[model samples]
Target: MKTIPVQLKSKDYDILIGRGLRAQIGTEVAKVWSKRKIALVSDKNVAELYLKEVHQSLEDAGFDVLDLVVPAGESSKSLAQMGDLVQQMADAGFTRADGVLALGGGVVGDLAGFTAASYMRGIAFIQVATSLTAQVDSSVGGKTAVNLKEVKNIIGAFYQPDLVLVDPDFLDTLSDRDLVEGYGEVVKTSVLHGQDFFALTGKIKSVQDIREQAEELSIHSIRYKAKIVMADEKESGQRQFLNFGHTFGHAIELLSHGSLRHGEAVSIGMVMISQRFEAVGITEKGLTDEIAQRLAAVGLPIDSDLVGTPLFFKHIVNDKKNRGGILNLVAVKNVGEPVIVAKALDDMHDFV
Candidate 1:
């Protein structure tokens, strides 16, 4: 198994990446968390696929496991779900000493991680990322959140997991849309990670190509993000760079109301911001088109009509990146050159 150690000051952990790691879940979980009980959290889809294997593994290690399976979708990431999941943990007699094992993609990770972060003032949190998006991006950042009706990640905390398991074999079962969804994050990372990595990612032509390179690329993206997170675990400075396409991407998500996936929304946001700025002599010329090509190469959407509209502006203003009314938006000047452009919320309308 390949390993990447995220050496944070308060919460240091290792992201274990390999094939067939699911069968080894018990040994892995046992090594990191010495506590007794583990509340394994998963979504309906993922649980149906791999829950039994994981459950048996954990049980073999002598953990009193409580598997909580919720409906699979963005809707599951909510205040109501959060309340219900934690209440279930309380009823199960979970305490600060017990741990939470997140067993699906980002939504499950965020829901389960937050459940761990807030339950009895935070407990052990472990992530076993099953989707390509979770393995490449969300699983490592330690930012746990649940979306509000109109806002994204408004209710969240910086709670690091005790461990993260990224098994590339899990990507085999992803639907075409689900597989393509992950490339949105991969493209974003390639763009932010500089030209060499960008060129490497641009070479991927299809979902098959991505699957072939999943392990290698997952390591690259996680290692890049882990470095930034260690430098700024609270997202105060360098860490903001990780959110290369998330500013307006999040707004587009709210506008879609579940029609657009997070990856699709971010793909559009990345191109839109690049195009808008490149037209005005801010971002490098043709950068937007280049990015759009790479995204389109892997079947990711690069345009969204909902962006730049009045309702979109309303949603963008509520972004967490906005600081004291001045929105600090990330824009690309060139490949590997991303800048934070702070604009007053009032003048943001002029930007569009």
Candidate 2:
């Protein structure tokens, strides 16, 4: 097991990366949260898989435990679901002193964290990520949100978790499609933190290879994101670097009407961004090709069906980083290097 510390402005937490850590949550986390009641929030899929063991562990620790299950998928991360979960917490007699245990993938973590942050002001959150995407990226950062009617994560907050418990063993139960879907995040993170690219790329020859490398790559991606989020806790400036492939990624998600997986859209978006970087002469020769080749090698689509650059650009403008009509576009100077460029929606004609 490897441990990484995430130091935020108001709180500091640790991300525990290994197999079978879920079973040890009681022993490992009891000291830090001995007094607070534990609210176990997970999706129906995960609740079926491991919720009982998780619930028993917390109960055995003598902490008041409330287990709440939500539907699985992106739709679960919404204001309506958030409202329902908060009511569940309230019905369970939760207090501000209590903390939330997000026990599933990214969607669960985002919605649970959002609920914890908004309920009675705010509370601590613990991430027990069961999906590769959540464990590697979304579960580590303080960025918590529920999707709005017209946008992805349109309504959200920055509430750091108290601890992140990653159990790689969960990957064993993940469908091949979900595992493949998460590889997109791994590849995106690897591109930004290039030192791991070779190792990450070599671990998988095809989509079928995801299971073997999912755990290691997930840890690597989380550590990469942690380095950036820790440096800029509030996203005041530099943390935007973590949005390297997210600008177009979010747009793709929006354009697909939620049909696309977050990482799938991100994989396609990264390719488009790389191409745009090359077209603008911001990228080194052949680097864009390498990006596409690597993504394709793992079954992620490099080309997008989102034609009509103007329409796609419209969705880009809807990003959270857009301030005063300027979208903070995360582009790459090279594989593993991220630079933020502030551009108006109209200025994206050539790129999008």
Candidate whose TM-score is highest: 1
Per-residue lDDT over 1-352 for candidate 2, one digit per residue giving the tens place of the 0 to 100 score: 8899988668788988988788888777786786668889999999999999999888888777888999888889889999998888888888888989999988999999999899999977888889888878889878899988768898989998888888878988898667777778877777778855645665577865777666778777877789988888878777887777778888887788867888888888878887877787887778767767777887777777784456677777678888988888777787677788778766777546
Clashing residue pairs found in predicted model 2: none
Off by over 4 Å in 1: none
User: lDDT at 119 for candidate 1?
Assistant: 93
Local lDDT at 29 for model 1: 91
| lDDT string, candidate 1, 286-336, tens digits | 889889998898888888889879999888778998899998878888888
Candidate lDDT scores, in order, read 0.89, 0.82
TM-score of 2: 0.95
For model 1, give the 10-residue run with minimal summed lDDT: 238-247
